[model samples]
Target: MKITILGTGGGARAHTAKLVELGHEVFVGTRDPEATLARTAPDIMGNAPYKEWLADRPAVTLMPFGAAAAAADELVINGIDGHNAVAALSAIGDSLAGKTLIDYAVPYIYQHESEHPWPTPWGVMPKLDPCDTDSLGERIQRALPGTRVVKSFVTQEQTTVVDPKAIGAGDHTMFVAGDHDDAKLQACELLRSYGWTDILDLGPLVCARGMEMYAHMHSAIGFGLNQGFGGHFGIKVVR
Candidate 1:
């Protein structure tokens, strides 16, 4: 399975490392591979520079966004930051045609003026755009009509997403929603490969609104637990 993850951020790295461990060929997409490799300082999230991280993961190949997407066998994970994802992915639409894009991005606008701001340890909580009526998943699907977009993995941290058993022996439930049944099945197959025992199909892509909107609540939960930033936890949908 050749997989392309279109981002160099922390979350993308998590998926990249796990997929490589699962014996899948992983290609990471970045805006500029040379620029990414030239970074000396950590990212905004304080994660180590991309070059430093890549040095340790010799198996992972890094390439420009389009090239990486074209190299995937069928699956591509859109790990690009929510705000910039649509534009970035739209540029590589041709490369992604006929592929299953499991999008885990939340459309967050990091800089905004709010009368009542929701502040976290990492600064003011970002606001979601196209939140209620539309969603990033739908936007991506609209942008790339030839691509199969499935909204998932947005409800949990990437670490927990890739290795669910680390929390509660993987008792928690993962969710997937998309208009394409076969694409959702592909997502579920990957989730199972990651050891997810329970998965709930949340119906159509419109349901992505709820998933993306859950970002605020996810942050609140982390603050409530005193975990700060990325909380180490999981949620189970009890029947």
Candidate 2:
């Protein structure tokens, strides 16, 4: 499968690593190509020598955001922030008319610094914006009338996203909510390749409202649990 990851954050890198591990062709698209490349250069050099040594690697592509969406095959995961989701979508919304976009944004309207502790248990789990009554992923879905938008993987830490071995520490579940059965299955296959053995399909896209809220709660768990950096959650099903 040809995949395009449209962000430069850790989540983007995690997806890239997992997809490449699955032997699929992956293209990374970012807004700030040069800056993202600089930040990832050292890590790529140390961890992904093959990708780094690829003859056609672009480190970052310079296309407009809309162009990036047009270039993808069947999947699009929004690894960017909730605040930027609409703008990013606007850039590529038209081109993504008939594709399945796997949305992964938590619309936290507020955040904190070390000095200013948040009232909530998780600083990352701030109150969302007024307009985010439903959820940004849902909003993205509503905005793109034709695109099949599925929400998933918004309830965990960045470090645990691609490493399934780390799931033994009580962090390995990835939550998904979408309207399309086929799109969810395709995403499940991608998740399987990323070492995610367990997934919770929380029904349709409306369920994303609950999933996003839970992800907000996880922000504080990381700090309080002392899991510090690599914490995540997964379900162990018994037959």
Candidate 3:
């Protein structure tokens, strides 16, 4: 399978490496391939520069957003940062038409003034926009009407998302929600490929609100466990 992941951040790197390991042709989309390759310093999350990371993964191809999206066989994972994802992806709408877009972005507003701020190890916790009523998944679906959008992979760290067995022997649950049943199935197939044993279909794009809203709880759980950010954990749904 030829898969396109539209981001150069840490989370995107996790998916890229895992997909390549799974023997899938992976094309990573960035704003500018040259600029991304030119970075010398680590990203905001302190992950190594994109060039340094890609050097170790020779099988992964890096291209501008549109070209990468067009190269995908049918699946495209939107790993673009939540805030900039809609605009970035909207620019490449044509390339993504008729594809199953499994979006895992949470619409985070990184810089905001709050009377009661939620601070974390990484700084003030980012606030979610279009949060309570709408979600990033729905926004992406609206932006790309030709695409089948599925909301998933947002409730866990990207590392855990790609390697569920890293925690609890993959006993925890994964969730997928989308208006298009076929698209949700595509997402579940990828999740299974990632070794997810228990997947719950949350039903409809609107349900993305709850998934996105769970970001705070995810962080809280990490902090409660003394693991800070990028905590290795998973949430299980007990029947």
Q: Which candidate wins on lDDT?
A: 1
User: What would the TM-scores of all predictions be?
Assistant: 0.99, 0.77, 0.98
- Tell me model 3's lDDT, rounded to 2 decimals: 0.94
RMSD of each: 0.7, 4.9, 0.8
Q: Which pairs of residues have clashing backbones in candidate 2?
A: 122-220, 171-232, 171-233, 172-232, 172-233, 172-234, 173-233, 173-234
Question: Model 3, range 1-239, lDDT digits (tens) per residue?
Answer: 99999999989999999999999999999999999999999999899999999999999999999999999999999999899999999999999999999999989998799999998888899999988989999999999999999999999999999999999999999999999999999999999999999999999999999999999899899999999986789999999
Candidate 2, residues 1-239: lDDT per residue as tens digits?
76777765567767766677676677666675555435534452144322343334444343445667777788877777777887778667788888888877777666534454455433343566423368787788878988888888777654566676677854356777888888888878777776777787888888888877775456556667775533555445443
The segments of candidate 1 whose C-alpha lies over 4 angstroms from its true place after superposition are none
Report how far residue 156 has shifted in candidate 1, in Å: 0.2
**Candidate achieving higher lDDT, 1 or 2:** 1
- Predicted structure 2: lDDT: 0.68
